[model samples]
Target: MTSVDLHLEEQSMVVEEDEFREGEVPKRKNKKKRSHADLGEDAEKRGICYLSRIPPHMNPSHIRQILSRFGDIHRIYLVPEDPNIQVHREQASGFRGKEFSEGWVEFSKRSVAKRVANLLNGEQIGGKKRSSFYYDIWNIKYLRKFKWDDLTSEIANKNRIREQKLNMEISAAKRERDFYLSKVEQSRALNFMQERRKKKQKTVGAESDGTEEPKVIRQFPQNRPVADGGAQTKTKLSKDILAGVFGGGS
Candidate 1:
């Protein structure tokens, strides 16, 4: 092979290796771009369902170590301690209450959560004697479909239907109350009319009695002087007049 001698100058400018000439095509860089579906799938795979009645002493690492046997675990959250709730602070120190020991767990797939739930359903986690974390296997459940809107919508619809039924009952009660009130008013009015009619009839009867013909007064004949001498005097009405007054000699 023929060799060419190259001269090097100290502190002098030299063409750099990998330098491109003018108008030369640049090398293409391969950058991978993720699709929307891929991103969605990634989010779904690592989806978390809030777990309750979890043993507080059971940390995320301990839980992951146990659950990793079933499937890949993306993350474990001991439901962020809430300053508002005193129980969380207490549980962090080892004491647990009867209420929920809530936390979230993200797995490699939705099936992983289901699988973990199935496997850990009746399994024990913590305590001096180590009792089951979940009260029931079925109770170790998930928020369906990872959409809070669906849950809220269902709750809202239930409330609305309940309100509607309550409104109907109230309306029916109001109608019944109004009907009774109307009936009472009608009874009062009828009684008042009857009283007025009775009063008018009494007044009319009094007036009719006052307008009736007056009774006639009759004068008795003077006793005869001869009759007075016999120690008693008697007054006598004529026979015809007596007959006419006493039903014509019945």
Candidate 2:
């Protein structure tokens, strides 16, 4: 399951010291509260965030210690469960493939995370390339506005706020256009159907009155084909029918 942190926002600090007596713990101090700017600053300074293409056997503490030389570590955690846990566990001998080992160290400030990241990102470490560990595939990004969560909720909220107004405008225009076009289409279709029905009614009425329409005979131009002797033949017209119809050729 993907874990996400939400409820991050720019909030004003309220001084509520009067609610508690002198002996009682302050409510503000008791609650674990941190600001976006504070987290961002901490991540920048102390975060030596990295993803390693190594085995779980490789301890995270050793890597953490190495990173401590660069800056103070607020907290370090290894992604305990693998996303491909099921597939890998199914194979024999633990699949013998690389696992994702990520490391994060919260520096004292943003400058430190930046400085260390810039210096050691492409630099060598532990006799091999520093990239041999988790530094390479780290989904490391400097969160500019840490007050907002790096999650779908935050993204969805921003998207909804932005697109809600725009989408409504588009939807309204689309509905109006569809209604207008549909009316025009319906009118045209109705007119065509009505015209066809009228023509059919007329034809039926005429047929019922026994007034048969005259049939016109058409004459087609016929070209004579070549005879077996290899000579083209001329057309032999019906003289009697032609004379009766046209009153022409002697």
**Number of the predicted model whose lDDT against the real structure is largest:** 1
**Residue range 43-121, candidate 2, lDDT tens digits:** 4443334434334444444444455576654444343445467366647456554344543444555665666666665
Q: What is the lDDT of residue 206 in candidate 1?
A: 91
Best by TM-score: 1
RMSD of each: 23.2, 20.5
RMSD of 2: 20.5
Residue 161 alpha-carbon offset, candidate 1, angstroms: 2.2
Q: How accurate is candidate 2 locally (lDDT)?
A: 0.52
Residue pair clashes in candidate 1 = 53-101
